[model samples]
Target: MRILSLILALSFFLSACETVKGVGRDVESAGEAMDDAIND
Candidate 1:
């Protein structure tokens, strides 16, 4: 039971990490696009 709980928690943490990373990438892309527009 303890092992199962630990595994579940780890899975959630990893999932959250991926979600945050995706959001970061999206924000970075938006910033890059804006910069390009401003420069042009």
Candidate 2:
């Protein structure tokens, strides 16, 4: 039972990390697009 709980918690933490990374990439892309528009 403890092992299962540990596994669940680890999975949640990994998924949250991936979600944050994805959001960071999206924000970076948006910033680049805005920069391009301004430069053009």
Candidate 1 Cα outliers beyond 4 Å, as residue runs:
none
lDDT of 1: 1.00
The residue-by-residue lDDT of candidate 2 on 1-40, one tens digit each, is 9999999999999999999999999999999999999999
TM-score result, candidate 1: 0.95
Error of 2 at 35 (Å): 0.5
CA shift at 2, candidate 1, in angstroms?
Answer: 0.8
Model 1 clashing-pair count = 0
TM-score of each: 0.95, 0.92
Our model 1 lands, by Cα RMSD against the true structure, at 0.4
Q: Which 10 successive residues of model 1 have the least lDDT summed?
A: 1-10
